[model samples]
Target: MEQKQFFTEKPRILIVDDELGPRESLRMILKPYYEVYTAKDGISALEAIKKNPIDLVTLDLRMPGMPGEEVLKHIKNFDPTIEVIIITGYGTLQSAVEAIKYKVFDYILKPFNVSDILSVVKKCIGRRYVSGEIKNVLEKTKRDTKSHSEIYEQITHFLNQLNESCYYFFRRENYLEFVRVLATTLESKDPYTVGHSERVCHYSSLIAEGLGLSPDEKEKLQISAYLHDIGKIGISDIYISKDGPLDENEWAIVREHPIKGIKIISPLGLSSEVIEGIKYHHERFDGKGYPEGLSGKNIPLFARIIAIADAYDALTIGRPYKSPLSKNEALLEIKKCAGSQFDEELVEVFIEEIKKNDREINQMH
Candidate 1:
């Protein structure tokens, strides 16, 4: 059977096993479709991973000298993006659970069916290709000082290249994971703002729970909250990490993030609700926000929930221009701005939720 190559370069696969028969069997199965490499044990596997741009590894858990679990940790520490599959004759419930904890793409017992192996390998390679394409889009967007229109065109072209695979890549878990990676990448640009998106997502979920939002609504809101600040990716690091007040010009660039975020993500065919949340998260309830001064209920519901959550995080973490506030002090400020900066009802719900989970919330921060 012939496998269609979706990438210009063949995706690389490394087979690591202590036994010759099982190792060579995997090599034979994968070689025709991928650039395959072989490592007889964990030590050699780590060396091969360093020497080659290996996209995937099929690891045997009981390898001698260095355990496969240890190698998996090193691989993730080196580059968490690389995909892995565990194939072991001695596979046990404990080993499978442990493999999942390390985020292996799949755990398969020995004597795996040929078709099943092929299916999993195909999906893994496809995922890797899609991730690479997205990274390229983001890198080009950041590196090239292109006009907004140009960036949109580039993203749209990349989407077109995905063709039918768009459905597969946007599957629930895959989509959320990719968005988290993008959010993490954006936060990496600023030292003070690390984990900002994840914290905001957590706060937003708490508010959603308080509001009794449907599971579907909660899912969309989670995506929106994580991506609310994605537009900041386009803004220069000088403004993002600045330790002092921004001059009017710097402030202007900072304010453009919402619009930039909308343009960057709108082409990816996301739901309007998700896009609106990103575009309007900074908008205030009293009609004093940027990009659009949408007031009260005029703001999208997801955006309103995210607005309160985003503010709470920023206040607690403290931006470069502001000193950090204690959780109680931040809650007090949020309470004071109820109708002015955030939706009034949502503010009450958020505050109540925070108080209920004070201990857990404190630990999260």
Candidate 2:
């Protein structure tokens, strides 16, 4: 089946500058025509892009930490169709020129004329692609007084005529991998639960298949399971390291993880299933769960699947306060709570899947 096609409503433009004044000013100027984002420095600028699709960036030539040119290089390497325009001071014209080689769409002088900025942006809106001819023009650009050469102007006009707007997926593959690494890092906080999230992912996939979930549902389930516990990354080491049972206060903090998970994963532009799975996985079948008491079918299907796998992993892997349950013991406990803690039908499917000890369950077997 064809993957679902994703679309963005408006062009997203990021204004990257260390100076708050200029960054805010650019955001204000572009706010009407586009969805504008600001970054105080280069690192945050790249992070912002990772969080969402950035159709264009009006970049300040100078910034501390990561250089503007380096950020441009990363952006081009990530997705060349993302148009970049240099916003440079008179003294930094040389740096601006350097960025052109990396496929900067255009440049404007600092203390920019609103008309000039708007003119270039208006022309660039549907003009995200860069042709070889345009790059050759940038390469051959001789310091000219007419803002840009005649050839560059001709190429720009030609591009505008082509109307090449870029479309991007809400989440990039590399960023999703980065999020996996983050989950791994959180698990690292306790040596016992190391690889816990990954195990849950594997088990969840098997459960999803046993339930005859569609490929799309399975795919989303995999992503949600991997990222489900990301909120634990925010928990203090003190709490995560406590060797004894958690007090009521500590338990409250622990229970807040679902809410925290939702917040951290909100900007990722995930599907509603994936987001809801992360938010409501802890909810129970008997209307007795924290965060929300969503019961039975009220809880999202994906969340229920994740909850089964999550509980299985947690029980078999043990925790700070308890020893790991043996395979048979964990299965018994899961069976005991089939209707209260987990979806009844899902529980039966999961138990059969676990008993089958197929390749997916090799770890437990």
Candidate 3:
């Protein structure tokens, strides 16, 4: 598997213009702050992008051979993440309007103000690092797909590329939202457990906040809680939403979900604690859990927190074999298991939080 290496450094800006004076001035304008690259025409501009990671590109609409519109299409087809700011000449309003379809970041009319240019650049270069790795994957996928003229092959290749990028890109940068999406995807597979993971995350966060967890710890817990059930997505589709009780074999498959979830999230650069939570949220406090049952304080702290939340949500929500418990009923169930399935101290925190704001909790029948 080819790994995507995304940006982790100063932003790289590319300037594309046919005219000498404007291109030079644009380069000089952004030179002090950005690592700048310049190309006199669209052909050269495209090539320059291929050679290096680029955060933003400023392109002139009036290039000779490869017109700005065509170049912009190729750029979009190549790497859509590259922020493109169009430089339009007089009477080119029509061309600029058409370019918007390609999703150019914004258009900068000719005789541009320096401050306006600076502001646009600042806004477009949203990330500190360029998406170099995804760009490489996108470029390679396009090249491979283009080589085959069959529409079927092209569509298949495009879909595969989309999945690859979604998995890799969502794992980094904006990971919290990514975890939410992953949980939703899992819910779609298991009709019996809709919204289970998110409720777990919400409950766990409440407990974490009560414990005075630092912002970073809360983030880890949030991600862990959301993805704790992700491993179940790996189960055979037949077993996900089956109506009755599972046989021993089917139950075994269900139990392997934590490990499966860990594999799916392994590449997203999660902290060890978050990984631990996903892997051990089902563990028992009495040292009686599967998949390496380290008991008592030996279990990861975040995992312990997720376990309480996981159990609470399960008790409160009606599953295929169980009736939903009321808030107090669910609380009693959790309290009954505190010294066995959950961390006693964390349970105390969760109980306190619920008492303080019991009205906010769902009273699902």
Best by TM-score: 1
Candidate 3, residues 229-250, lDDT tens digits: the string is 8766456546656667889998
Ordered from best to worst lDDT, the candidate numbers read 1, 3, 2
TM-score of each: 0.74, 0.52, 0.55
lDDT (tens digit, per residue) of candidate 2 on 1-365: 01111114666788889998888877787888677888888888888989988888889888888988888888888887788999999989988887787768779898878888876775455343223233433344423423322433433343343222211211232233334544564465468768988899888987987888897777788889988987665555566657888899998878877777776665555789988999999999998986789999999998899999999998998888888999889989999999998999999999888877655557655
Give candidate 2's TM-score. 0.52
| TM-score leaderboard ranking | 1, 3, 2
The number of the candidate with the highest lDDT is: 1
Error of 2 at 339 (Å): 0.6
Off by over 4 Å in 3: 1-173, 359-365
Per-residue accuracy of model 1 over 1-365 as CA lDDT, tens digit each = 23344565778899999999988888888888788999998889999999999899988888779988898999999899899998867536478667887779887778867777877787677667666677778678869955645555665566565645645644664566556655775566468888999999999999999989898888888888888987776666777788788899998889988888877676567789989999998899999997778898999998998888888888999887898899889999999999998888999999899888987767877
In terms of lDDT, model 1 sits at: 0.81
TM-score preference between candidates 1 and 3, better one: 1
lDDT per model, in order?
0.81, 0.74, 0.75
**Stretches of candidate 2 exceeding 4 Å from the true structure:** 1-178, 359-365
| Model 1: how far residue 244 lies from native, Å | 1.5
